[model samples]
Target: MWKQLILLAFILANCSATEVKKCSDDKPFPLAVRVLNCEIPPCDVIKGTDMIFEIDFFVMKYVTKLTTLVRATSFGMTIPYELPEDVRDVCTNLMYHAYCPLYATEDVTYLFKFPIGNYPEVSVKVEIYLVDQDKDVATCFVCNIKVKKGPTGNTTVYEIDY
Candidate 1:
């Protein structure tokens, strides 16, 4: 039994985060997020391609006041996605208070059609932030993903769903 335990420990230590997505614990805002699209963490994405993300989360607060901001980082570069300026004013209150906050404060599903830049085959970490109008981060989320390399042989048009 002891030997078995030792073997298990060694295996766990050798495991890489590439096979698992590492997300930071919720702070300031406590929330739990579920990736609705992939089976594992560090979702597999093809380099120099576009990927889609679907997520469901619940926030521990009243939806009366908050701002949502999304940012993606890879190869030490950060990309920020914000509410479109043209419709920001109209959508401000709509998203923040879309649901009746009598019970759950933040509960929604988001869809992101993100482009995977020319970053090499590496691990990409994405951060989602919910902040107040004052620029204070209300809640933060981190998701680890992998960027796969392009195929070396002939590629099919149907296989271009990177």
Candidate 2:
């Protein structure tokens, strides 16, 4: 028993002596876009009609949270936003959100609301990244949204560690 205790103490000491590198490095809180009451994307729309949308996101910067970028691409579709200038170095190694319809590339927290007119069933991809690219690590969180149209929207929140 005495030998076991001594061995445990030695291990503990070594662990304490080792230096830990924090990815965030004492950065302040980050501004994360809080997507709330997001309704299931609306059904196919007719051409020449106007659609209005409202999006919400919380922006806090320097916060220790992950930010996501939304990407939309197709074989022959003209996407509005070109890829950002900085992500070319690590785009291939990106991890993506399995269910997000759009893919993301930047670290910006965006609440996007746009009108969809005369478009076919469009598919999207969502990807997230660590704001500090040097860390070479990726973290992702899952959020839930429900929309009831008109005036009442239902939503649920979940916390995940990555």
Candidate 3:
């Protein structure tokens, strides 16, 4: 009888824990992450063999105001689906807001331009995983993006649903 009561209590406690909503607690911004088209006024002048893409990630926290910004170490490819790589160089060097406050929004943009030797199709993806400072462990926010390469390369917007 005691064992049954303990088991029930454990189950209840586990179920009562708060489930982290994807990107919701972090910010009030649009649930959908939209990357607008890449446009350079004079299409002719901006033409280059290798295309450069800009990616921005916004952080919105719903819980305690976060004080530290975990340095992003790596990111996974979205469209082509490649393995994760060290993106510290791209993120740390070019981020506007490295760290964000609780419930506040911060944007980080990376200039991703790769040579188009054989691969014509261009797709950019950045997955953001939240790390707990105290625990020093990673949390699965499970946020990812996959943007298609456009013909004109004017404005390529990728909308991340979920």
Candidate 4:
């Protein structure tokens, strides 16, 4: 019985969702944010790997189209990263066969995969935004992440700010 209990606890901890902060006070925040294999801030991401994110959100108003915006802030500078044409369209990425034309009162989960590239080893604040067709933000959130070198590279150090 003790072994079973410990296993359950470990499973719960590993599967727990990440707590993220809202990017803007005026915009709606996601109900939950789950970064696969990550449950805490300053998530360690190795280069050449994919960071998978699952965002649970509710639509407060009808939206015919949705777009994703990703930005990384470091050293007091924010740089926007343009996703591929297919990944930029959020509607196509909705899970469970869900498509565009999301209606009010509908709960949806969006799965986003960000491919890590050859980025410098550093800590950055990542901001994600889902914009509706009207150019208004549907939901937004922010989190801190640390990028590290891959296995073949030398050890990289990251400076994190609270």
Q: For residues 1-162, could you state the per-residue lDDT of candidate 4 as single tens digits?
A: 999999999878766889788886767999899887688888889876777888889888999999999998998999997788788788989988888798997889998887778889999899999999999888999988899977665766453211
Between candidates 2 and 3, which one is better according to TM-score? 3
Q: Can you list the residue pairs that collide in candidate 1?
A: 42-145
lDDT of 3: 0.33
Model 1 global lDDT (CA atoms, 0 to 1): 0.54
- List lDDT for all candidates, in order: 0.54, 0.31, 0.33, 0.85
- Best-to-worst lDDT order: 4, 1, 3, 2
lDDT of 3 by residue, 66-131 (tens): 122222112343333232234323343234454333233544544334322333333322333333
TM-score of each: 0.49, 0.23, 0.27, 0.85
Position 139, candidate 4: lDDT: 91
Worst 10 residues of 1 by lDDT: 87-96
Candidates ranked, most accurate by TM-score first: 4, 1, 3, 2
lDDT of 1 by residue, 63-145 (tens): 44455566778778897845444322212333334443323454654333456667768887877665554565555667778
Could you tell me the lDDT of residue 41 within candidate 1? 76
> How does model 3 score by TM-score?
0.27
Number of residue pairs clashing in candidate 1, backbone atoms closer than 3 angstroms, sequence gap of 3 or more or interchain = 1
